[model samples]
Target: MEEESWQSITVMEDKNGEPHVLQQKVKVYTSGVSEESPGYTKPLMKHRIVPVKDIVNL
Candidate 1:
């Protein structure tokens, strides 16, 4: 497998189990492609990644 262009620095979840993307002060990877555009593998969420803790709680 190839290395991911970007990775989740940190992820935080809300009480409702909804992911709260902390986009400030954190580094997110970008291939410079818009999500609406084609061939975009990046997630459209505001956060880089969601931790397993969030899923378990939710």
Candidate 2:
């Protein structure tokens, strides 16, 4: 199973050259158990950005 969350904010252009207050959804996942420790698990966090507006140059 995995836990998830979301947030929104205004910022500058991204690597894709898109500028504006973008709406995005953030997600976080739980990783597998660690090899060094038994019964212990490590959390792995990953982020993906999706552009809701057109790309522009600064």
Candidate 3:
């Protein structure tokens, strides 16, 4: 198989074990920045390459 033609799907599961389609998102991280930087803040959440869409309101 050619790397360019390879594809895959990822399904996220909720706390109830329900599956959901993952969504694409861009996130900006402030890790390793100096504390004096305007964007500096504690790393609250870990970043993932693919993030799941919010389904709480569904």
**What are the candidates' C-alpha RMSDs?**
10.4, 10.7, 13.4
Clashing pairs in 3: none
Of the pair 1 and 2, which is ahead by lDDT? 2
* Residue pairs with backbone atoms closer than 3 Å in model 2 (clashes): none
Give lDDT tens digits, candidate 2, residues 1-58: 3445544445667776865454445554445454333332233344345454533443
User: Across residues 1-58, which tens digit of lDDT does each residue of candidate 1 receive?
Assistant: 1123443455667788866544323233444555444342444434444545543565
Which of the predicted structures, 1 or 2, would earn the higher TM-score when compared with the native? 2
Ranking by TM-score: 2, 3, 1
**CA shift of 27, model 3, Å:** 16
Number of clashing pairs, model 1?
Answer: 0
User: What C-alpha lDDT do the candidate models reach, one value each?
Assistant: 0.46, 0.47, 0.39
Off by over 4 Å in 1: 1-9, 25-58
Question: How well is each residue in 1-58 modelled by candidate 3, as lDDT tens digits?
Answer: 1111111235777677766655433233343455344432232233333323443454
Q: In model 3, state the lDDT of residue 36.
A: 44
TM-scores, all candidates, are: 0.24, 0.26, 0.26
* Candidate 2 lDDT score relative to the true structure: 0.47
